[model samples]
Target chain A: MSNGASGAEAHSRTTAVALSDVNITFRLADSGSYTAVEGASLEVADGEFVAIVGPTGCGKSTLLNVTAGLFPPSQGRVDIFGANLAGLNRQSGYLFQSEALFPWKTALENVAIGLETAGTPQSEARARAQDWLTRVGLGHFGPRYPHMLSGGQRKRVGLAQVLIRDPKILLMDEPFGPLDAQTRQIMGNLLLDLWSADRKAVMFVTHDLEEAIALSDRVVIMSAGPAARIIGDWRVPLTRPRDTAEVKLDPEFHRLHRDIWQTLKAEVMKGYEQTGGG
Target chain B: MTRGRLLSLQFLIAVITLLAWHLATTVPIGGVTLLPPFFFSNPVDVAARIFKWFAEGTIWKHLWVTLIEAMLAFVIGSVAGVLIGFWFAQQPRVAAVFDPYVKAINALPRVVLAPIFTLWFGLGIWSKVALGVTLVFFIVFFNVYQGVKEVSPTVLANARMLGMNDRQLMRHVYWPSALSWMFSSLHTSVGFAVVGAVVGEYLGSAAGLGYIIQQAEGVFDVAGVFAGMFVLAAFVIAIDWLVTLTENRLLVWRPVAAETRTQA
Candidate 1:
């Protein structure tokens, strides 16, 4: 027992997240079973931002879900902060691909919910939530419910909602997938600015290649499914404080984009063939 | 439509209906009554009956009884329904076991149970309240169950990820989701509550507006019957208006039809 404890402590010092030989199979009572991810091993170091990019049906989100400890992999195990995760991860925050803010709560209340659930006094939670709303450029919109805000504004509230929790690891699944190009660019830059100040282990999942390259220290690509696995990994050597839009104009960015696309394009075509161009 | 236009149209419809009723009942055709006053009382006589009831203040006793019965039924039934609904939603195995029995009970004609309720609780306020509860319970129960069943998966996941325990999740998520559904059917459930009370009274009772109307029918006092009906209609409308106000205040986060029009 003491040996296990020492091993876990040592693992915690070096790794923020570790998934060893994870396999996820979804059961369909009528059609048998479908494997989403198979024999996938990965790790995120403390304070490292790793982006997983793949084809449309490549099971990227499934990988992120495993990291979040929402559900255990059908085979193998997940470790969070070096402890074997048996249930919901207590040390991570997730930003969903779609709107996940409580529609019944106003922006301030939504932001404060994490604290409120953790036993913070209502008044103190509200005060801190208000501060986060201001940080996200929604100071005046605190009293407005999610429905009253435009899409971009609601996304800002969602960001504040997760960020206010100060989770040791952040799992984002296409957090800006629904926005228009202009808003997406703005949100990307804002995220980078916020993240740079207090670096945490981040595992971002998206199909957007430019987004993955612009925002990550390492970009990992997964193969198309029937049992998808990590197919490629690239080190994003872009300098610090790089702008998402401006960085695209860089010659190095173009070269990396081309190299990554060479691998990604084939997987995308295979996925399309499997789905009959859905 | 504009509020002013809508109000004028409503007033016009009411005025035309009343004018037609008065003419049909009072006007003579070929020196003979078009419709006998005994069967269809004149508008003036109905109005007079209403005024007389108000002046005597006797109407208050019956009105108060009915109101109390309906309010009690609404509160008790809503609480039970919401609690049971949550339990069943949380325990699907229990729900599956009892599903057929519940359906059978719900499908049974509620009015037929009035005599049974009277036998169980005696022919007084409790019997009427029991009937009202049966009517109120099903609507609220089904709505609460449906609300919980249809709670957004993403929201549920988000709540769990926020480190909310079971009790916290219930208070913050399930309760609010159920409430929105309850308020959506507020008017209908409350309306059923009143119907259950009045019907139970009309079938067998010594007091209440329903009893008054039943009494008027026995003597062929058409004006008194019409007066009782008008009073009942007004009472329901007033109560429903109050329900609407409460719903508006509680569900301020929800978008209303009027707000939607302006938004677009």
Candidate 2:
């Protein structure tokens, strides 16, 4: 088991998040149990972008939730930075897949929500929100409501909401799942550029192999449920501040992609077999 | 401009109808009054009577009394309904337990409550206001309760994940979700508010348009009764218009229908 000091030093050197033997289960009304994730252990090094890829419903989101401290695991522990996550209020930043921007608030206000929640003065939060919005290339759209913005723009606002906090760890749950392929690629590159600058450890959850490979320093492939676990973890040797388009042309990228695909293919098939497929 | 045109169309229809009634009463086909003498009581006579009432009774006095009663009921009922509805919505167990009781109360003939209210509060404006409040409360309560209950789980989860405390969640998510429903019910409640006030006045009251109408009916004055009804209808329409204006201002985010857009 990775101890506290090792995790801290690792973060100082580029480790952002650490989880040990984390397990999550849901109890049923019929007195039965379903283990969503079982004994999943992993470390996200500081400045290291990691992706957790799995077949649908493999508890990738459950793992993310545990990491965020939104849900306590039925077993094991999760530590962010060098600190135990027992009573920490705002250790990590999260970007939900749906963008979940408040419909009543403008894009700027939505971005400022995190700072406001953390007790930052309204003016300071608004200013920081504006700065982050500009960074996301949405400066002009600050006043537009969520309903008025397109899917891509809403995701940008969601990203800005988290980025404004500048937490030690970033957890994103399929942030670009709803966007078109082109927009998804654009967002992927943008995320890489943003992360490359500060290099906060990011645990990005996605089903897309291409997305995982493009943005992550390490790809953690999770197995299928009734008990989804991290079956393989591969360190991608792709250079930092990488261009997604350029990375695709590298033969090494293709090799890693093929390996990850081969490992995930069986899990995907098993998932299909378990739940009658598409 | 469209509003002006619509008003003009209504005036044109009123004039034509009045003219037809006048001609039918005067023509006297086959020595029989084709239209009853009371039915064709010339628009001129009704207009003169309205003018007399306007001058003698002072339209503002009666208008003020009715307006005060309706407004009082509207405020009392709406506030109580929202408070009770929100409280009930927050506790699912309690809401479920009391749901049938609320429905039964709502289903009971609210008009029947007017006489009981009159008995309790007397023939004063308070009785009318109380009756009006009873009628309005249930409509607003049910809508607000349903609205709060129907808050999206996805939105609630998102708010929770964003670290919103319970009060903040209620303000940001639940309140806004239920606001539109509450406003829609308000539009309907306004008429009921007026109806309750009028009914209470009719059952027993010394003042108000309802009392005037009741008095007219006692004297076999059909024209006066119709005149009183016309005044009440105008009052109801005016209140409805105000409610609509408030709704439009509050619900600015709601998309305008294609027809309204084209009309604009």
Candidate 3:
């Protein structure tokens, strides 16, 4: 653990993303308002992996969007590396819940899009894209377009596109949420492997408890909402290079899971009530 | 060899049609000339008249004139259509504001504009070219507009996240997405180009196949009309082939319906 900490600190300055009393609201067409997220405050440490778990409409996605500088908070402030993110488009990588590959470009070209837009030479960008594709085990598939690829293959290409840039902070909104269980497990492990090598500050949004436990150093659980708020924050004590399967068998893992689930269960019931599910 | 087979098929159909016509005309089953010599003339006579036209330099000269008019109109119309369509697609509010006006113009009987174009541009090839451009432009424009509109939102978001500026997005994303639609429109527009050119010529022209056909009609020479039509059909087929070849080359990334199944 000390070695892992020292390594992360040595490679890059820990860039903290702090959200102070952030409130976000949306206006409905018919003279009413909806509060997606209200008074949500959280901080993600640099070189840390934080997972957000919540019921549907709890504004987990909205929180990530604010963090990415995609949407402005109606109230409060978001700071990245101690710099305010007010009307400023931060250079952060975002992986949507969907694979989101551009159907027109070949996998290699899609991956190189970031570098090309940043003014890198086409040939150099392509070579670097190829290198990243190989890292994600899609070297031979680079020439094929996204529509030609299977869902799993497309997801890997999407990851490669984001990974190649090595952005200061990564915000993923249910990146593996759509994959089949087996594929999801494989992708989860792949993400951990990638992160182990270069531990960038990552904010992952998911509803899956096991996924949250497997990937995050900390888990932030949100209450159900007309106005959602963070209900629990658990610091995961698992060591680095952790085997997802092995971690599940650990006694501490079960204890943490139980603790988090107990907090979430009431919120889940309240979510059902709000949606008229009762 | 394929050309040989095509010609043979055409010959066989021609022979069958000629036999039916000859029997109908000579048999005199009714008092009416059901297969009139002045209107539905004998196929053999039409073949001989076509040979005479070929000898008189009538075939090559008029065919060349019509072909040039059609090609020029198609090029001008398609280029203008693509540019305007892309521009309109980028500005949704402007597109919405003018959409009904554009549709109103499209719905207006374009054939009626033949005389107006002739009056505006004189009775030269320019009038025919103008008419042809109007006919082809709307077809291509509508297709390209719809194509650009239907670009996947997910893909656009992904491109934005990847740091693609508006120019790069337009070049890589919008163009490729709209290309197949543009090609489909081009195929249909080829036929429209010929219609516009021939109709404009028929309305007011001293030259072109349409002029020859009109003269033949005035003289009760049915075979000449058939020969002119045969030449027009050949031109349409040739242009269609060119469009197909270009489509195949430019759209190599697009998998054919059959290829998609195989990949699956």
> Which is the leading candidate under lDDT?
1
lDDT of 2 by residue, B1-264 (tens): 589899999999988998887777666888887877675566666677788888787666767778889999989999999999898998889888998998888788877877888889988899999988988898888888888888766566666656678788888788987777888677789988899888888888988888878988888787787778888998999999888777766665444422233454
lDDT of 3 by residue, B110-188 (tens): 9889889999999889999999999899988888888899887767777777777789888878987777788866778
DockQ of every candidate structure? 0.65, 0.35, 0.44
Residue B241 lDDT (model 3)? 82
Per-residue lDDT tens digits for candidate 1, residues A70-150, read: 888999889987899988988999999887888889999999999999999999999999999999999999999888999
Decreasing DockQ order of the candidates = 1, 3, 2
Which has the better lDDT: candidate 1, or candidate 3?
1
Query: Which stretches in model 2 have alpha-carbon errors above 4 Å?
Result: A1-15, A29-32, A82-84, A87-89, B1-52, B55-57, B256-264
Categorize the docking of model 3: acceptable
lDDT by residue (B1-264, candidate 1, tens digit) is 988899999999999999988887888878887778889998899999999999999999999999999999999889989998888989999999999988999998899999998899887898999999999999999999988888898899999999899998898888899989988999999999999899989888878988899999999999999999999999999999889778777887887822644543
Q: What is each model's TM-score for chain A? A: 0.94, 0.93, 0.93
Per-chain TM-score of chain A in candidate 1 equals 0.94
Which of the predicted structures, 2 or 3, would earn the higher lDDT when compared with the native? 3
The per-candidate count of clashes, in order, stands at 0, 6, 0
Interface RMSDs of the predictions, in order, are 0.8, 2.7, 2.1
lDDT pick, better of 1 and 2: 1
> Between candidates 2 and 3, which one is better according to DockQ?
3
All candidates' TM-scores? 0.95, 0.87, 0.87
Clashing residue pairs in candidate 1 are none
Residue B178 error, candidate 3, Å: 3.9
